[model samples]
Target: MSDVGRDIRLVGRDLPVGAAAESYRALVSELKAAADVLGAVITSHKVAVVRAADDLIDSLDPVAVECGEVNALRREGTFLRGFARDPMSVGRVVDEIWPRGEHVVCLGAGGSAIALGRHLLSRPEPPSLVFADRSAAAAAHLESVLASRTGVRSDGSGSVEAASAVVHVGPGPWDELVAGSPPGTLVVNATGLGKDRPGSPLSAEADFPRDAVLWELNYRGDLALLRQAERQGVERHDGWQLFCHGWAAALGPILDLPDEAATARRFAELAAPLRPRTGGQ
Candidate 1:
């Protein structure tokens, strides 16, 4: 299993959803022996488990079903494949901005950082992208990996690869990063700081460029980032829509749904009533 920082595999008491404290290796063996391993459902924090599964597979391969910081995993035939579902939401959310900015910066080089950066970096005529984290190593690892994906080959240390000339990766203290952003910039809070715990990634002294779009990935929480964005009077969005798209996209491959406009629209319509309100008010 892979994680950005700490590895808190499971949280709280097992409750009724109990499972053994088996090693990832043992779990993979069990999964392989099961009657027709359909697919695996994964949450972000459990990503390392999937990576372990990928390593254990021999007969078939592990494919990445959903792409983002964390991916949904499944087995095919003797192949390990990785799929990113987050891009479906990422693209949609960015499109709503009508005209996109010349730059896109993602704060926090966690799982979502890799997934989001990949999507943004791969687009034709992509905007200049920056991913900054408190840990230089973490930020570099992300940058190196992302850059290498451009057929550039990264050293896994997040060094800036020359092949991917458009991106700028760096360390955190994002206030300066935010302050220098161009107007209409697209800024994302992928840190999971405010959502899971509390506090904003940016300091109160940070400046948001005019007409920028602020996207808070956690729909519900004590969101300090969203409040700051709102205070700055920028166009703001919560992750509710993105969350819907993520599930739909992840399930698409599993349920064999068509990747059509109608399908996406239908998914959104169905999910709308179920999505809780996430305004900072």
Candidate 2:
């Protein structure tokens, strides 16, 4: 393939109120004008916009691949931290609920949630995946794309088959879905309300069945759900683990590198410049 036409691109789509679509819409021209745009992945912090851009890019069928097949690699704040955790524990959860217990629910629509949903789609039996976001239209669009390759639904309920499933839960700064899960259920919290921000999906004091595992995708203290889970005597997973787990998956394709392990090595080398600059993490 010729390198001349190989470039990563982002398209702007209309957004819901409070989202920064206008700003991103303006950047499209500037991004397209820049040199060395090829091989670079376009990213957006907003989940809906990312999905829109992803749809646009897929329509163009660019040669460049997405990072972990995700349009953006967000930091471990609220949404990303949530996505990072699913892959970390999903395998173990799948093993526990194997053959029949292969349903996974993501509580939001963001880079992290998309990454986890994609990861689960690659597994054996391909756990039924669902995308429960406040934006019903965005959830439908993303769910459609996810189900295109895997036999899944995002509606959360219906057709319990060996496919991914999605559910659109409107206006949730709530956790009714996660709290209602049965034992050994794999529930991932992919929202940003309880990160450095206050207000968790469900009450920190809510009683989660012993068989269910609650993991929050935040890395810092004073605002992390991990701490809240601890205080509530709930078993929780950490955000950094999600970061590490998803990193291998996301970086590989974005970097045009080999397998997850090789991509990790290359990224470690690239990050060497930051070790002394940031004093290493």
Candidate 3:
């Protein structure tokens, strides 16, 4: 493989966000001046890292600024740059699957919610968005954030509330959200219920749209949502592709690549060696 085309090593450390607040000084102190380290990929302190990397020649991903996940980091000349690319991954994956004329109902208004909302609005013929979260305020905040990004007021001429295209839904009515959406609507499971913990977002009696497309943002572990979608014969997808492109996009700029696709292609070729030798069953 060429120098730029080779797969860059991805090292990870899982630190709790709460602890990051208390230990940030010591943490960064330890991480500083580690020459072999391209950067540190910190999941828990996503927003904190982005803010810290803002000054000087270092770069931070705009998506990471919006949502708080899948950040790519690299240090250059004493500055650490952080980038979040999950939104791009969502765009690429959704484009290949549903493309146009698909209203999207994203379950959970967290980082993925922000990613989905922004991408849906940017499409040539943007799909309508509905953010459903256990917290009503989070859903509302997502709508407001997307409105600002889309260049409209919360209730402006083309804003979510004005046209009724995008709605922020609270808990206990998830089934209603699903039933109300158009058939073939894109339903995203951005919540950590199934992966980070046990259980599915939708209740046992919840029903999906007639031909909905379900995108569960978890590759493994308890996959109640994926199984539910499959049982209903829905077009379902997992997080593997999202994971690949997200990392590719996040690290693209750091690696001096022009675009996410190139990074992804190179990584795919390199990862081929790790699949078969990968054990566990």
- Which candidate leads the pack in lDDT? 3
User: Per-residue alpha-carbon lDDT of model 1 for 1-281, expressed as tens digits?
Assistant: 11212232322222111233255556556545655554443445434454455456443222132322234445464343344565555666556643444677788776666666666656544566777676665566566556644544444587544324233444445887777888878888988877776888888778898777787888878888888888778778887766656655655554455663355566567767776566622
Query: Which regions in candidate 3 have their CA more than 4 angstroms from the true location?
Result: 1-8, 17-20, 23-29, 42-45, 48-70, 149-173, 266-281
For candidate 2, the 10 contiguous residues with the lowest summed lDDT are: 75-84
Clashes of 3: 0
The lDDT of each candidate is: 0.60, 0.47, 0.66
lDDT (C-alpha) at residue 245 in model 1 = 65
TM of each candidate vs. truth: 0.72, 0.60, 0.79
Candidate 3 C-alpha lDDT tens digits along 1-281: 25356656766556653354435545554555677766664544444544343433244556655564335666775776666666777788778777876588888886667777777777655666777777775666566667665543353346443222465565554778887889778888888777677788788778898888888877766778788777777788877666667667766766776777766766667765553321111
Preferred candidate (TM-score higher): 2 or 3: 3
**Tell me, what's the RMSD of every candidate?**
8.7, 9.5, 5.0
Off by more than 4 A, model 1: 1-30, 33-37, 58-70, 75-82, 149-173, 260-264
State how far residue 198 of model 3 sits from its true place (Å): 1.5
- In model 2, state the lDDT of residue 186: 59
